[model samples]
Target chain A: MRREGSPFKGLSVVAFKEAADHMASPRMHLVMLLVILTAIGSIYGAIGQIKETVGQDPFLFLRLFTTARDPLPSFMAFLGFLLPLIGIALGFDAVNGEYSRRTMSRILSQPIYRDALLAGKFLGALMVIAICLVTLWLMISGMGILLLGLPPSGEEVLRSFAFLLTSLVYSGVWLAASMLFSTLFRAPATSALAALTLWLVLTLFWGMLAPLAAGAFVPIDPFDPSTAVHQAEIAHALARLSPSTLFGEVTLALLNPATRALGIIFYSQLQGAVMGAPLPFGQSAILIWPQLASLIAGMLVVYTIAYLSFQRQEIRA
Target chain B: MSTPVIEARGLSKRYGPAIAVDALDLTVMKGEVFGLLGPNGAGKTTTILLLLGLTEPTEGSVKVLGRDPLREPLVVKSRVGYLPDAVGFYDHMSAWENLAYTARLAGLEQQDATRRIAAALERVRLPHVAQKRVSTFSRGMRQRLGIADLLVKGCELAILDEPTSGLDPQSTQELLELIGTLAREGMTIVLSSHLLSMVQSVCSRVALFHQGKVGLVGKVSELAGKVLGGSYVIELEAEGCDVPAVARTVEGVSQASRLSNGAVRVDARSDVRGALAAAIVAAGGELKRLSMDRSSLDEVYVRYFEQVDHAA
Candidate 1:
């Protein structure tokens, strides 16, 4: 018999083939249509917002381009809450579908390394999502240019680029999460449901409970207004354990130039943003440094667990 | 020296408490059809998976093409083709598309991939169904597609696990012929099957697997000679049910019984047909059906397994 060599040198082709299949699949088409409609609608509405405002602060008018704290929470927080869920949806079934097909064993039988397989798949999925994100960012920027008579200033573009990177990294957390779930679970439906449930927990349930739990651990009562502020700060820090909080905090930093303190929320009023002395993006990154590290760390931890589990699993199926 | 294509030393696999494959030593030489005949859950698939490096064994060593499968899976896998017991595939892709994708994954160039896929499909007699969706294909068609995939793999050793299983008789015959063709081309194939007749027809060397071990192993001709012990079946005409009486008059008679079709069936320890034929006429029985049906692989396999089971 001939001495066999590595047969899976064409992993890139496999990745490309899978990505093409994803594009052809009905679900991806629906996802594309939904994202397109939302982007177009957001662009039209932003144009509408620019046309109607009068006598507003120049900073406040500029603020539409960069987020600032107001009666509503920061702009970045909302995007943070939504974008990762989209990432999760894109990846949740990536591994489990192969398991269901009884093809995972056949794939593992090939000469390619396990990490190569995951890397190819991750890069493929990332490319697909990046296509969507770039289109949305371009639309937002174009609308700002045409309607608001503002091509984003140099500083604004820098922050927006940083924001895009942060968003991608933040989405990496979800991709890592969903891939881990796919490996852990045998069924595609279960992997999907589990990812959705985790998204709900981070975005909705954790938002409500983690702060409240932290508040309960505090020594002070809220009836004392001045003291309550101190207690709520502790609650907010504990609440940031979930990715939603880090996303909320980081988006706030990227979107609102006036919103300073690196992302440390000191005020008791969760809805109210701290009106602090303006700080540079460098300083702001320093403040939000811990949260970003946590997000990156979270992704690594989950991926490591999934990789180990995948390596250990029998190829019986 | 020509190294054996596959060599295993005390190879065993245990799934938690259940022993899937016990300590076993095995080998398959280059350019031969080696068959492992056993029932389901008899470690046939486990053994195949081991060879592919899809699973790590609990004990012992498995070398495919002189490389440890677990340590150098890709090295071995690139030269080994496999057809699983149930030929499952992606439902969405057409047969040609699926074959092309696999070929691409197997590192074939675009032109070579195309050429190999078409040749494989044609070889499996699936040229017409090449463009059809795999989900729409019948079981036989899917089986053909699987063989096609293996063919396109261009491996020296083909490990086919129950390749013709669940196929109709005609398909089974066709599959056996396909194996024969591949074997003639000098591909070393290790085939596992529950179908005794199929294994017997296709495999030059057969191993009787029982309870995670090989109960018996030898060439079919050698085992047949050993089992029959110079015995040959003789068919002759007899009056109704008096076939036994004519057989009793024959010298060197070992066993005799009347067949369902009214022909006296006799198994002798030696060439007693000449004596048996004379005895039939002397006993007023006319010889009508006289044919020598060699003892089949089915009987040899059953006898081997049963004897092993009894000893255990």
Candidate 2:
């Protein structure tokens, strides 16, 4: 026996097979249907709003992503809420499902390292997510062209494409979280619930708790206006701890060019800035670079934990 | 002699305080079918996992086909195929797809993988159901498919853990015959099973495992001969006479006893059937039946385990 080849000898095979399985799974279909219907509905609401609102807006196409109807949130908001469900659906059963189905041993027995198995699963799920994101982007842009009859500017295209990339990393964080839970729990349902519970806490409850925690950490004087500013800053920092908050801030910075900064801008900071002036693509990207890096870092951290755990796991079943 | 296909020395595995395989040494020769016989929880499965490098041993080393399994696992795995106890396949995938996935993992190109998958399915006698989902397969078919998976990988050594388990007698016979064919074609196989009769029929050499250790290891016949030490027995059925008393006085008869079935059993250091028959006839007793009793492998197996138990 010789050991000269790459450690990723079987990665493509496993990735292709897993991707096909994810594509065919009913859970994937259900999540995808939920995302697609909500996305279309959101985009439709944006288009109707554009039709009713100011007719001469230059970045009309971009507004299709950020604008919302009176009752419905924007498409970006829906994605920030729903994309994790898709990510969790794809990954919650990745490792344990193999164990439950009794295929983990057989798969590992092949001439592949554990690195390849974990890498293949993550890559396969990410591939599915990429496809879904690209399809939705194209559909929304296509529908915008059909209804609003306005071609997007180059800046609009660049900004919206950046938004899509940021969304990928955002969902990737949840996917890695789900895979981490999958590695921790042997039961697929348990892992799924665990991932979902984390998602719910971060998306819904974390916002409410961050302010209270920040108030406790940085107590403010009731009569001091500057201390109030300090409290708001603390709350903002605490909220940034959640991946959803990071994603939301990134979406705002990318989709709305008129947005200047993510945090509370002081009067001195806004002195040189023009009101209603859209930032350049480069500036907007620079503004959100930290958020992007944090999303990627969160994903890698969780995925690395899952990968190491999987490597150390006993392959009995 | 050719080099051993597998070698393990002082190999041990401990899960917390429970020892699964303890300081075991095993060597398997090339092109021979080796059997690991043990009852449940006797470390047969753990030993297989250790040999495959699926789990790290606590205390020793293993070399499969001249490569250290721990250091060169992919190399060893590429040459070895393992069919775990109660083997499983992707239930939603067709048999061909399942085999093709393995072939791809083994690094075969598409054209080569397709050709080999077809050949393997045909070899396992399951080419007709190549496109059917595995969930719809019978147990025998799934077991045969497991073999096909090994075949497609072109593994030099096939490790089958309880291969005939859960199969009907007819299926077991067929699987045994298939194993025989593979062995004759010069494939080294390591088979583990608790079924002594099945192991005796197929294994050229065997290691009887007890309490996480090999209690006995040798050729079946050699172990029987060594343990029994040339002692032989003769059974006789006689009527109208004191058969047990007369048989006890025969030359070379060490012990004689009347069995519950009205047959007299005589243990002898030499062949005593002819002498016993002659004495019975001379005593005016009717000789109903006379036959030499051969020591079965089952007896050797039972005695070996009993002796080990007593020593423990």
Candidate 3:
């Protein structure tokens, strides 16, 4: 059944058209609208406050803008949570919407392979997210320059870009998650619900639930702060298995480079140091690497499941 | 002779414990319209699915254009256009957008894709409202868009499943005309329908499926020749007479059904009019009416199916 050369000449033509149709869809319009509103709102909100904060102390603006110093919980919260949600929203309907449109079967009937469909969709959604996120990031920085009246240090600029890369990768994880759900469920509503349920598990419940479970099994006292934090860290690792929160955690770490990496509960910075202290970044990364690996592995696992399921599913359905 | 565009040798499909199609052999030659006629649960759709490689065969092999659809589906599929029983379209897209999408997938260059999109819409007579979203299109229009999608592929073999299922008489007529034109253009077509009249009118040959098997297959005329033998049946107003002797005089007459009221019916091999007329005149009986009747497709379909049960 082998063709001597490439066979998708006509199929690519068709897939390309479907991909274009995807771009002009109403869902793209809605995502863009939300992105525009978020950028405008965030920029103006910073503008409204930048003056007073700058006047209060000459160093205040420098610390906030030029360095990661005094990074507020609210900024981290917005960057960590809202951006990933946007990624999810962009992709939640990807496969399921195609299924609903009845274009999926038609496309499959062509010579285009199944993976190309997924790849095209992922690329399209990523481009859309890139546009929105990049716009927002630039808008915020522009507002900072105008109001704070301070230039970002080279270090700050480098870190911001690093943070942006981290944010993009983090968003991709959610997009994959959303698409995985899309393939798992046939109905768009069900796919949306499944994605949100994952979000809630990662964002709200996983953090609290893991610690409680570990604590229950260990049955340690709160006065033992180290023990409790250990449990929380373990719980966080377990929770990070949910790609959404793992991405959020990774992005937060990138935004503020001072924070310790996530993974194992380090007894102290010492690997049998003369005296045990908090773990160093090397030890922390070593500990966190496993969790990171696990999170990446989990994404692949779900994606693989979706791929196999789709390959196996009959066109009759 | 045209090459066989679709060839299947003992094709079969089983959905777990249920056998959807069983040991079915078929071949559809190029540039001819063939039909698979059956009722709703009689496996017309299953046979089509097997041909498209949408479902794997449980027992036998299928080759379209000399390629196994299961193994080289992309190559075969690229050359084959399929319109499922219910052609589904994205409701949000206009007919033009939908056609454009399919055309691109069919591997037409941007320029050619646009050209074919227009031509297909025109062929279906849907060019005027090309930009109208399928959501607002009536059932007939949606079906038209569906046909346009299949045609845009520019494939050699076209498969239409339940093409006229819900169509009104006018739309059905138009669709039939379009099909006639495609056939004239030498496009190999596989038409599945439950409408015997439609099949009888357009199909050169047919494969009748029943309970997951091809119960019968032959040229429509040949099948008609074998199943519908020479016979004449007429209701008559007649007084008492020698009905058997009148029947015997007709050459090759096999049997006759005589009503108690003296109306005579006869089954014969050749034209029985002269012998019957001579017998009638000699016997002093009046021939009220005479007409000929042959075995119909409906009866052949019934007889073949009943034979399946008897053999089982």
Considering lDDT, which of the candidate structures 2 and 3 is the better prediction for this target? 2
Question: For residues B177-250, could you state the per-residue lDDT of candidate 2 as single tens digits?
Answer: 99999999989999999998898899999998987998778988777766666667678899878998898889
The digit string of per-residue lDDT tens for model 2 on A12-47 reads 888888899999988889999999998989999999
Score chain B of each candidate by TM-score: 0.91, 0.89, 0.83
Q: Which regions of candidate 2 fall more than 4 Å away from where they truly are? A: A1-5, A223-226, B226-295
TM-score for each predicted model, relative to the true structure: 0.87, 0.93, 0.81
- Arranged by TM-score, best first: 2, 1, 3
- Considering summed lDDT, which 10 consecutive residues are worst modelled in model 3 chain B? B229-238
The number of residue pairs in model 2 that clash at the backbone is 0
Report lDDT (CA) for all predictions: 0.75, 0.90, 0.69
Compose the digit string of candidate 3's lDDT tens values, residues B137-182: 8778877877788788888888888888899988888888888898
Give, for candidate 2 chain A, the lowest lDDT window spanning 10 residues. A1-10
Q: Which ten residues in a row have the lowest lDDT in candidate 3 chain A?
A: A61-70
Ranking by lDDT: 2, 1, 3
- Candidate 2: DockQ? 0.55
